[model samples]
Target: MTAGAGGRPGAAGRFASAVFGIAVLVFVLAPLLWLALRAFAGSWTYPHLLPSQWSLRWWSQVWDTPGLTSSIRLSLIITPIVTVLAMIVCLPAAYAIARYRFPGRQLVLMTIFATNAFPRFGLFITMASLFYSLNLMDRMAGVVIVQLIGTIVFMTWIPAAAFAAIPPSLEEAARDAGAGALRTFFTVTLPLAAPSILVAVILSFLAAFDEAQGTFLVGSPDIVTMPVQMYSLIGNYPDQVAAVFSIMLSIPSVLLLSLVRRRVLGGTIAQGFTIR
Candidate 1:
C-alpha cells in the first residue's frame, strides 16, 4: 500500500510508463514501416491496411535510374570532405571556447547558435547570389563551403560541450608531467574527447550527406549528390521511387551509427576521469 522508499512507481504507474514508451516507439517507427512496405509494394491502394502485392521492381528501377550512381558517388566524396574539414575547423574553436575565458567568447558562441536558428531555405537563398558572384556556384567547393556554415555550427557545439565537461585537472596533470601545451592536448585532452569527437564526425558527415537546400542552390547537374538525385527522381517518378530513395539514403547513416554504436550509446569523452 505504501510507495517504495526511493519513490519508485507502483504497478499501475509502471504499466502506464510501458504503454507510453510503446506508443512513442510506434509513433517513431510507423512512418518508416509504411515507407518500407511501400518500397516493396507493387500496387498498394487506398483502403488497404497492407499491400496487395510485393516485388523488387521499384528497387531495380532505383538502381538503374540515370545519374543515381553519380549522385551517390558525389555524396560519398562530399560527406567525408565536409566532415574532415568541419572537424579541423571546429575542434580548435570548440576547444578554445570550452577551455579558455577569452573576451567575446560567449558572444562568439551565441553567434554560432543564432546562425543555426535561421531558416535554412532563407539562409541558402541569400547566399546563393553571393556564391554565384564569387564564381563558386555549381561547384563541389561551393556546396562544401555552404554546407559547412550549418555543419560547423552544429558540430562545434557538440564537441564544445564535451570538452567543457572534461576536468581541466587531467590536462594539468599531463602538464605537470613535463608535457607541453600541444603535447598535453594531443596526449590527454584529445584522447578523452575522442568519443564525442567521433560522434561529431558521424554527425557532420550525416549533415553534409543529407543537406538539400545549400547543395541544391550551389551544386550543378555535374555535382549532383544523393539528396538532389532523390529530389529529381521524386519529381519525375512515382512515390514508390521516393520510398526507395529514402531507404537508400538511410542505409549509410544506419551503418555509420552501427559502427559507432558503443560510443554513441554509452561512451563519453571524459567518462573515467576524477577531479582528485
Candidate 2:
C-alpha cells in the first residue's frame, strides 16, 4: 500500500515482486539449464548437483550424426512452406469469414475449432489410412498436408479476428479515394490487419515446425523433420545427444520469437484472439 520515491512501489512490495519474478525465471529456465548441462556434461552421476566433467562431445555428436543436418534443413524448408501455404489457403477463408455473412458460418468456425479441441492421434490414424489410399504416404506433400492440419485453426481464427477488428470506415475511406475493392484491401485493410496476421503467421509456423506425431505417421523413413528426428534421437542416441538435439530444435523458435518479441507482446495478438 505504501509508495516509495516518485510514487513507485515501496521496498516490501518491490521485494515480493522481485522474489516472485526470480522464482518464475528459475522455473522457466531450469529445464533449459538441465538440458544444457546434459548436452555438455561428460559425467554427471547421480547424487551430484553438478557435472564432474564438462565437454562439447555431445554437441559434436549432434552435428556429426547422420540425417541430423537434413532434418534441420527439412524443418527450415517445411515450416516456411507450410506457413505460406496456410496463409494462401486460410487467409482468404479468414477474410471471407470476417467480412461475409454466409450459410453455415458458425459451423465453419466451430469446425475449425473442433480440429484442435479433441485428441489428435485418432485423427492422424484416420488420415494415415486416407494418405495410403491416395498414395500420399512417405511423400513431402503428405508431410506438408499433415503439418497444415496443425496450422489451420491458427491461420484462420487469428487473422479472421484481426480482419474483423478493423473498422469498415477505413476501407470505405480508401474506396472513396478512388481505390478499387482490391486496392482498398491491399492498402488500407491489409496494413491494419498486418500485425495480427503476423501473429497468426508466426503461430502457424511454430505449429508446423513443432509438429511431430502426424508427420511421423505420414512420412516415416523418407521424410524426417526436426521434430520427427527428435523421436529417433531419444530412442537411438544417448540422453546427452538427445539434449543437444533438443537445444538445436529449440533455437529457431527462440530466435524467431526473440526477433518479434515486442510485436508479439504488443496488443495485436490479444486483439486477434478476442472474439467479438
Candidate 3:
C-alpha cells in the first residue's frame, strides 16, 4: 500500500493486482486446458504432465461414433427453433407489459418471475407427466417446448426492460412526423431497444442449446441431443472422445457470446434483469 510521489498507489499494488488476475485466469481456464490435452492425447497416464503421444485420433473417433452426428444435428435443428419460437411468443408479451398498464400486468410479471424461482427440475418433471397425456413425449415439438420453458424469463423480462427504458419522446416524435403506431414502433422504439433484445436472444439461444435434463426426460430414446449424448458417452466411451465432444458443444456458445461481450460488459443486459 505504498504511495507514489503524487499520493497515488505504488507499483506494489499494481503488481499484486496483476498477479491475482493471472492466477484467477489460470484457475478458470485450467479445466479447459485439461480437456484440450485429453482430446489430443493418445496416452496420458498417471504422473505424466504431458501426453506420450499426441494425435487427432479422438476427433476422428468422435465423428465416427454412431448416434453422435445425429445428436449434433438434433441440437442444431432444435436450438434455433426454440430461439425463434421464444422470440415470437415472448417479445409481444414483453412489449405489452412494457408499454401498457392492464389489470393483470403485475401478476403476469410475477408469473414470469415465478417460473425461474421454483425448482426447475420439479417443474419439468411435472410437465413430463402432462406431456405424456398430451401425446407430446418423444416428439420434436415436446423437446422444443421443454427448451422453451427455461427461455421465457430471459426473452420476456429482458426485452420488457429494454422496451421500458426507451424514451416516450422517441416514439411520440415518430408519431408526430406522420408515422402510425406500428411504423413508429418499427422505426424508433424497437431499434432503440434492439441491443438489449439481442442480448436476451443470445441468452435464450444458449439456454436452449445447453438444455439437457428436460430434453432427456421428454425426448429420450427417440430424440438424443448433444448434451444428452454426453450422458451415454461418459459411461460407454473413452475419456478423450467425451472431451472432444465437450469441446464441440462449447464452440457455438463461445462464438455467439463473443458477439454481445461488449454490450454485456457495458451493462445493456444487466439493466434488463432489474425490470419491475
Candidate 4:
C-alpha cells in the first residue's frame, strides 16, 4: 500500500524484462557470432568463442574452390527468373481472389494453407519422377517451375491483402471514366497496391534466393545454387566455408534493407494507395 513499496516492484519488473531480452538476443546470435569469429580465426581447428590466431587465409581459399564461381552465377540467374515468374503468376491470382467473390474461395484458401503442411521431400520426390519422365530435370525452366509451385500461395497472400485494402471507389471512378478493365487494372489497380507489391517482390525474391530442395531435385548438374555449393564444400573444405559465403549471403540483405527498414517499422503501408 505504501508508494515506495509499489515503486520497488515496478523497478524489479523492468530489471527482469531487460535481463530476459538480453538473454534471448544472446541465445539467437551466439552461433552466428561464433561462426563469423571462427571464419576470421587463423589455425582454429576447434570451435571456441576466442581463437588463438587470426588471418584472412580462409577467405582467399574459398574463392579458389573450383565450382564456387559457377554456383554463385547460377544462384544469381535462377533467383531473378523465379522471382519474376512468381510475381507474374501470384499478382493476378491475388487480385482476382481479393476483388471477386467466387465459389470454392474457401477451398482455394484451405489448399494454400494445406500446402505448408507437406514436407519438402514428399513434393520433390514426386517432382523428380515427373520431371525425369518429361526430360526437364536439372534445367533452368524446371527450376523456375519448381520454385513457382511452392511460392504461388505464399506470395499471393501479401498482395491480396494489399489489393483488398484499396478503396473500390478509386477503381470504380476509373471504370466510370470509360477505361477498359485491362487498362484500369494496369493503371489503377497495380499502382494502388504498389506498397504491398514491393513487400511481395522482396519476400518472393528472398524465397527464390534461398531455395534449395527444388533446385536440388530438378536443377541439372549444370545448375547449382550457392546453398548446394556450400553443402558440397562443407565436407571437403569446412574452414573455407565462413570466409567467403556467409558474409556474401548476409551483405545484400543488410545493404538493401538498411534504406527501407525505417519505413517497415514506421507503418508506411499507406504507400500502397499512392499512385506516384
Candidate with best lDDT:
3
Off by over 4 Å in 4: 1-9, 45-48, 256-276
Candidate with more favorable, higher TM-score: 2 or 3: 3
Relative to the unseen true structure, what is the C-alpha lDDT of residue 62 in candidate 3, on a scale of 0 to 100? 81
User: What TM-score would you give candidate 4 relative to the actual structure?
Assistant: 0.84
Candidate 4 backbone clash number: 3
> Candidate 4, 176: how far from true, in Å?
2.5
Ranking by TM-score: 3, 2, 1, 4
| Tens-digit lDDT string for candidate 1 (1-276) | 343557978888788778888999999999999988889888888999998998889889877877787788888888888888998888999899889998998788887878778999998999989988998998889999987886786577778877887899989998998999999998888888877877878877888899987898788657789988877877688888889888999998899889778866674423312111
Q: After superposition, how far is residue 123 of candidate 1 from its true place, in Å?
A: 0.8
* Per-candidate total of colliding backbone pairs: 0, 0, 0, 3
- Residue-level lDDT of model 3, residues 12-56, one tens digit each, is 877887888899999999989988789999988989999999889
Candidate 1 CA-lDDT value: 0.82
Between candidates 1 and 4, the one scoring higher on lDDT is 1
Per-residue alpha-carbon lDDT of model 4 for 46-129, expressed as tens digits?
555477788787777767766887788887888888888888877887888788989987677667656665787798888889
TM-score, one value per model: 0.87, 0.88, 0.93, 0.84
Where does model 1 exceed 4 Å of error?
1-15, 259-276
Local distance difference test scores for all models = 0.82, 0.88, 0.91, 0.74
What is the lDDT ranking, best to worst? Answer: 3, 2, 1, 4
